[model samples]
Target: MVQSLAGMMVPADIFLSWGVQFPSVLATVAEKAAEAAEADGTMVLLAVLLSLVAIYTASKVGGEFFNWLGFPPVLGELVGGVVIGVSAFNLVVFPETGGNADNSLIMLVLSATAGLDPSVAEPTFEVQSEVVSILAELGVIVLLFEIGLESNIRQLLEVGVQSLVVAIVGVVAPFVAGTVGLIAVFHVAPIPAIFAGAALTATSIGITSRVLAEIGRLSSKEGQIILGAAVMDDVLGIIVLAVVASLAKTGEVDVTNIIFLIISASVFLVGAILLGRFFNDTFVALAEQFQTRGRIVIPAFILALLLAYVAAAIGLEAILGAFAAGLVLDETEPGKELEELTKPISDVLVPIFFVTVGTKTNLSVLNPAVPENRAGLVIASFLIVVAILGKLISGFSVFGVENINRVAIGVGMIPRGEVGLVFASVGSESGALSPSLDVAIILMVILTTFLAPPLLRVVFRDEEPEAAEPDTPA
Candidate 1:
């Protein structure tokens, strides 16, 4: 390719394409040779790989330290990302986060050692950052799929009415309180406030459920209530996101499109699960015939990714499809085996999701010394208060269970997790949220996420711990 493109100014994408094979020290050195051959071309592959190195290093170190302290490892990963991301080290900064070749340490390392040209640094960082972003997105998808696999639909159904009430209140309370407060009190516009309210509706089922599993309460009655409600929250959150996204995009709400999203999302989730169940035996029989290394896992992976794509294509989040696929496959005979096999993949990919969320956060706005930042802090405080109080009240809405852990249920739903980041990103990209408001939303997300796990441990500490469900596999 270098020989073919010689004497032409090589595009950044050529290096990006070669980035499919992850770069090594050898690859970095080889890139110097390639640079020699194609004088006009510069390598971004090394920069990209080095960024991932920083990401993984931060994830593991933070995760381990947090695990040691008896907090969620995912929280540590987020903090580690903040330390290395735009907020601190600049080693893992993204283009959207005011990071560029001039600011990124990894890109500088490449320019110094890998012969990456200074002139192409920005373009290189753009491609490299976009790749990292895509990986982070995939990480969340895998995390949700894993959550789905672990979940028992029967348990969710057993607590269906309570979960429904909790989910509805959990969503409505935060949304109404946030939107109205932002508008009537803060004087923010209706659209941006609505978007912010929608952001509040997310319950990071990934992190919350992960915490429940880590603490051995995952199959408890309270845990089941939280899980079922979180799933419902995911569905309802999508509808709210769609409505706001449409309003933001066109400045006019499309009621017709909104209805379609609601119907399609419902039908897609139910139909996918039903279809997966109907075909489970056939899938198992075909896998039994293969006797191959990845016979079960590979097909399961394909189904997950395929369904994820379908969900996204039909105007819902891709994670929904991946999750539905997991729920379906969990009912199959080889479910446990497939889950064990899938763990390694989830371990490799899911940290990227948590860490990147931290990386994109600029908590610098919360500083009290800066007068402009003070306003953001005020708004952030308002949001943080409403966000916590609003969701915390959701547990009381759960009806008719003896000695039910209402506080535990509310605390479980407090973490908006990565899904809140999705809402903020959408609003930011669509110009719906002002920078101050954006920072406020981010603060709400980060604090809520970081606070949930320890709070869960604290809330459930006094209760007689419920035994794990007999049918639910660890």
Candidate 2:
């Protein structure tokens, strides 16, 4: 029977008829299935999963490639994001449709079946994009927490007057440069100018610390000063961000509110440190009794998240809380173990945050042919120059510290990295900065982040090599 059925030759007309009907039937079935899935909200889940796969794959490959090239892995991740994002390949897109709407495979499939125009259709927010955005935010929180874990409050105190001077100068100079350059030179409004300046006050400890560690100079005197100054910069930067953000929201800067915010922020940080110290032993003891896996790590992570929530609740950036949690967790008996466990988590999330930041950057404004884009490029150029010079001058602030490569320190402080991105994101969301200004800020961030690592390597080449050691807190 099988042989008879296999050997049966269909008539040419019948064969042609089946072949034509097959695709039509299959397409009909698929269309119905898709409609059913949409009704059940399954399409949203599928889209989200697809997005995650795409984002993580792109970020990992990009990060690894950059690492191989001897640059910071984050730079590679950022570049990769730009390559795959709407501004480049259009592999991923947001709710709005236009431009590369036709280029995105997912968008194409949806648009075709829905009878939507790729160019003119208004797309609704997919569940997947929202989830991706939330995860990206959590990634930043984890990144800040990891930074805090590596920091030692005692070491920060030990760096003393030199670090203090450097930190102050670093924060103030950039703030002045950004504000003055935008307002006086670019003729930007006062509120937006303030936001731009606040962005410059940020110094990415993660970038500078990683560079120093890679060069085996993390424990050097200059490294110590840079770390200490970075810590101070984080504190000052957050305060400035809070004040400026408040001003942007209220349309006025209240002196009383600014002073209160500064005091509140300081008290919260110090209080968190003291509270963590007091509870460290108790938490460790409790963790030891838990027979289940991830005892120490789980509890520590919860603490970080809890603090982050509290910080956000109190009108401060959640990163400050995450940092404080790390500081506190560092004092635990299982601190080293917690750090080891947390490293893998950070390894996954941190790159996602960086890549997401890169993807959000609109490269269209940087085009030179368009008159408006030309103006934006000019503004970006001026901002980049100011950003570079502002931090460069801070390296010379340490007058009393001898034998320290001030140039290296200055270069070390130059990369704004994730911190600047955060500042710009906040400013844009709050409507404090115009789209052009935001793009300019991102350009400044990208240039500074990319420039610092190479410049630091060059500046440190003449110095004697320091022995590689485990990271110590500062």
What C-alpha lDDT do the candidate models reach, one value each?
0.78, 0.75
- 1-474 per-residue lDDT for model 1 (tens digits): 122232322323245446564455336445544544533233656766787899999999998998798655766887898899888989988766788779888888887888887766766776677667778778878877886787666666776799999999999999999999998988988889989999999887777777787677888878888988987887678657756765675565467865766677778888998999887997798789988799998889899999988876554667778888888998999988888999999888888877887787777877788887887888999999888888889988988898788999999999987678767766775678886788799888878987898899999888666555333322
TM-score of 2: 0.83
lDDT of 2: 0.75
Error of 2 at 181 (Å): 2.2
Candidate with maximal lDDT: 1
Collision count of model 2? 1
The most accurate candidate by TM-score is 2
Candidate 1 residue runs with Cα over 4 Å from true position: 1-42, 204-224, 238-251, 418-432, 453-474
Clash pairs, model 2 backbone: 152-474
Instruction: Report the lDDT of model 1 for residue 421.
Output: 73
